[model samples]
Target: MTASPTLFTRIIAREIPSDIVYEDENYIAIRDIAPKAPVHLLVIPKNVSARLDEITDAEEMGRLWLTAVKVARQHAADYRLLINSGEKGGQVVFHTHIHILAGWENGPDSDT
Candidate 1:
């Protein structure tokens, strides 16, 4: 049987609409539908690992972080890189993703 598509997969396919911020051979970044800060972007791998634990190599993880950092710097704002690993980790979407939040006017400072 064919696997079902995740929300991010559909977005990447352009089956659903999204504000794409960046795109490359292996990844795509989009504006988060729910804003947690003045600036928020969701960076996801096109490879579609359902969760961090499912990732087989460091390459994908490395690429995701590199992209996130590039995006954060481009925005010229201090940023938070968040990855909610599993259900207990508060990950709403099954597809693994990085939440890039910046331009924090008010909020507790990130521990990192």
Candidate 2:
């Protein structure tokens, strides 16, 4: 039987609406629904790897980093690259993804 799709999979397929930042053959970058920083983007591979360790030596791995860097450069600002590998690692989505936090800003409940 075919495996079920993850949230990121649906997003990549355009089944669920997401603010798509960039996309190509192997990867797609989109704005995070729940923004952790002022500019939070999720760069994900189209190929389902589940987590970082799953595809360490894959060619797509390098592409993933390139894609993230490309997106980060667009902002021309300080940014942090994060990856939540497993469940306890704060990875709500099992699909491997790179989190681009471009800097702190007033969050929803912040005293701005």
The TM-score leader among the candidates is: 1
TM-score against native, each model: 0.89, 0.87
- lDDT for 85 in candidate 2 is 87
Pairs with backbone N, CA or C atoms under 3 Å apart (clashes), candidate 2: none
Which residue runs of candidate 2 sit more than 4 Å off their true CA positions? 105-112
- Cα error, candidate 1, residue 78 (Å): 1.1
lDDT of each: 0.86, 0.86
lDDT of model 1 at position 37: 72
RMSD of 1: 2.9
19-110, model 2: which lDDT tens digit per residue? 98888898899999888777889999999988999996766688888889998888636678899988998888999999998755553345
